[model samples]
Target: MAFLIKRGSKKYPYITARVRAMKSKLMPREVYPKLMNMDIPEITRLMGESEYKQDVDELAQKYSGLDLLEHALNQNLARTYRKLLRISKDEPNYLITEYLRHWDIWNIKTILRGKYYGAPAQEIMDAVVAAGQLGYRQITSIANMESIEDIKSALANSPYYSAIADYEGGELSTIENELDKIYYSRLLASIGKSKGEKLSLKFIMTEIDLKNLKTLFRTKKAGLDKDVILELLIPGGMELKSRDLKKMSSLSWSDFLKRLEDYSYWSAISEVVSEDMTSLMDVEAVLDKYAIEYASKVSHYYPISILPIYDYMLRKNNEINSIRTIVRGKKVNLPDEIIRKHLVM
Candidate 1:
């Protein structure tokens, strides 16, 4: 694996060529306009004839309509991500796999929340994406556990167990925060030595900064104290320091806007604070757009690196999310303008 990874730079021309080919197959912006006019079954049929064909066909027997769409999307994402891992066998593969660990965090949170909400075990299992190191059987077992404590015990042997176990009380917020911290900590830990991997490190750090900023902004909007906000804020952002976040957390809304004025994130932060955008939803929209733009720029400069793969993955995920949003919005009879606003395009 190390040998293959070390040779990746030389092999990069080939790898990047393949990635570009795959990237070109992605649904274009024009497709969405036509898709918006189609019914659910028509949409499924359209997808069946496209890149999602095999997944759609395989899942056709068991699921239909939205369930089918969701399952196909999940399977496609998992398959594509796993293929990336298989192709790039060394450091690049390791870095990509580490990033995919977010799915592990996602799976854990889904199981915990499903248990908390008393969802059916099968339903919880259906919702999980088995793209991480955790096997499907382990996730199924976790889902089958009768109580949250039993689920926590199942996770006890995993890296997230210790952080999650410390929150003995049944506060979902505490458990969730611990999970967030563990995810980000693991991300930084996986970076290891960063001397030659500045592009990868910068991309990951920028993501962390955006995530922390979103969390802090939400906490402030909710009138939560600095300590509470810090509890959820991951510590490894590149540009935003803990002390700076602490200071921002302590400010009044106006003061917070002032503090962010000189920062790179000033424009977005100002929009949220000055416009009194009470909802974190809009703030999150801007963050996603900003992150995508930043990742796109990084990938353009470092095409041979993992940046392109990361950018493609992010964009693909965004595309799936946009589709899901459109389907749900249509189902709810939301105006097209409102739905467009909800989209991250």
Candidate 2:
């Protein structure tokens, strides 16, 4: 259970108003499909007309096609997140800072995965976003490091050190899982007790619940037994308690589906989920859609508080993600319907 430390908030009015102005510029869900039909050059032309125009133009002489777009998008994301830290103060600052550590943890996971698979440093670097506490230079340096032990030594004093300390190049999933648990636990520990805190808490807990649900789907699909699956579940969700997860994990596949119907999330997954289903990909997408919709819906209630700020951040992040998905999907000649299905919004 997460609570908050009491503190007087400052300048949510200014920050909220500013973010509202920025939100107006985000591409709506409808805009993504149109881009799916566009080629890389066409999409680049489209990007040239948006807020990314300057970035696209400035990098045009140096790079073109997908290369140009990817670099521009990464630069914009880093700038946007940095601006959030610069503009907000007090509790909002604390909240945003902690939450953005998600990028650092994500970058770390990408690095570990890359190294484990012997991917080149440049390939690993391409996957990292310098939007968190670690700056571009630091992440670059870590990417170039010789070994996991070397990386661990560099991060020794940081919050994430413990999450990876025990790893001796074992299953990277174990380390990834620990990174997630540590991230949320640290975030909940740092949250403050303001009027807006409960909303933030709800957002975080819902994230945990959804993450656990995705884990549940994957584990069950792989035919993992109850005890193993329970070991994999994260604690501290809004609902779907450990005991509940245990009970569901122990049930027969059909009984597990029956048990899930009692939860609010069941409605979103009902049609796509069944004992005969061979894939949980569609079910997982519904959960992701629910998370996006839930974040946007609850944000309106606390207009001048941290809720809008949080929503704006996620919206901005998701827009670029959708854009990338379309561009990449088209480049690979994936079917239009397949691209649409992969889109989160």
Candidate 3:
């Protein structure tokens, strides 16, 4: 709806300038190497001097150790993303807002899972990233709900409500799958009427292709019916078609690999599948890396578009995951090599 403002050829100098400055301030790859070796306090101290200073300082008293690190990271990510939303107005802002809505889907799913597992409200609250369309109060209220049904009711007005409410069973997977579908479906649908926007089209198509490939591999492994797989598939992928997926579904595992050989993701998928890996974790990591790389490239071409903000969001999420992986690995004293393998970077 924000795309109703058609200021074609208008230069968003203010927004683009601000974003460029922020992009320059992101922690460099070299910084990660140094941080990886620092103790918790040292990590905190180092971060205090960076853009994360205010967040780290604000959260320091109440939380220490991993809690402190996580809170600061989440807060910083939220602040950075919210800044982008504030600076961007009109069409660009709308696209960024739509993408950030994924965080709402994320928060909803996290709350539902937490309630289903009977996790304490505080624990659920800690896991949420308040960087989406959902207001802080809404997330807090949802987090405090005692029952999964209450959580569902709280989300009745959310974009996910329609899709999630359609599930007949109380299974958490049903809700989760619906959430995933809604996120992707909305993402594809929000490309606006700007069929000429190359950057936007590329971002959506690449995302769809990555997701479709993941779904195909997982459904094949689970020995699910082709119809069910198709049901799970999001439309509008650049390379994947319903017919291609159907054909792939009928082939033997080896034959399926052969079929995918000519596809763009074939190399990555081939490596994982050939090893007889049952866990889709590695495949997911490969996809994450690829997605990041793709976004980075798009940002280079369309710096003023929503691509950079989305790239930054993806990188921030990856950074948190990478840090968590490192911290947990160090806590358990896993070999650095093993920990490195687990990281998406």
Candidate 4:
């Protein structure tokens, strides 16, 4: 990822027109099923004919199997996101840059988790997608640091360093959650008095609702204590208020299902929230489906705004994740039915 060189004009009408064209080039939803039926080599051959061709071809001689697929996917994802920042101008660029910082948060969490799990620095860099304010050079330096404190010191001048404070190296999840809260909090804070900005705020709040919903589902499924779940939930959701979430978090698994009926998202998760389930994959996939589908639906209503860019970003990410999920599942010989259930499309 490269730095913003020249600040171009704030042309939503112009930028959005280009975004539509780029979005149209994204892999279609129907293609995933076909890819599922094919082998790795077959999938690679297929992807070679699509947008990922350059990435696959360039790495084809150096890697094979899952390695080949993962590298290609990560490279493409990083390049694709960086391209958005490169192409966007002025206000569009700012909004896109701010939104893309989520990837930076993701990279940070990946580093912390990798180190906590005793993973090597090289392994850590494999998962680091430098598509945000932090480029590959900065990320590489942080990943190779001797300790978390080293990372904190390296990031002291940045806005996200606060997330690393008060760390005792125990619950990395807590630090990860703090980083997320900071991202959404800072993003919400950045939205100003413009009508377009208000719509963006509403969109982000809705995302927070979905994110908080995922957190609740994971924690609740684990039968974690209410306070623990409450601590993990971020504030400022559009509908999933913190107080309401607190009350819901206090319920048992069965009672949690009953409580969910009071909210609008219940229909999306009801089928997968049964008391007998062992995994939360279905519920999470449904939530992802809800988010991307909702974004796609609402974006057309506000075409010449940040919403279209927002929608494209989510869809692009889903493309990478969905492809990876399928490829990884197939490589490990996971059951097709189980793999399909986890797919967002």
The candidate scoring highest on TM-score is: 2
lDDT per residue for candidate 4 within 141-218, as digits (tens), equals 999997878988888887898889777576687889899999999999988866667778889999999998888888
Where does model 1 exceed 4 Å of error? 1-11, 167-169, 194-196, 268-273
How far is 340's C-alpha from truth in model 4 (Å)? 0.9
lDDT of each: 0.80, 0.86, 0.76, 0.87
RMSD list, candidates in order = 2.7, 3.6, 3.4, 4.4
Candidate 3 — which pairs collide?
none
lDDT of 4: 0.87
lDDT of 3 at 153: 81
Candidate 1 vs candidate 2: the lDDT winner is 2
lDDT tens digits by residue: candidate 3, 205-250: 8788898888777888787886777777777778876677668767
lDDT of 2 by residue, 72-179 (tens): 888788889999999988778888898899999999999999989988998898778899999999999999997989999988988999989998785798888889
Residue-level error in angstroms, candidate 1, position 210: 0.7
Q: Using alpha carbons, what is the TM-score of model 2?
A: 0.93
Global CA lDDT computed for model 2: 0.86
**Candidate 2: regions farther than 4 A off:** 1-9
- Ten contiguous residues with the weakest lDDT in model 4: 1-10
Ranked candidates, highest TM-score first: 2, 4, 1, 3
**Alpha-carbon TM-score of each model against the true structure:** 0.92, 0.93, 0.88, 0.92
Q: Identify the leading candidate in terms of lDDT.
A: 4
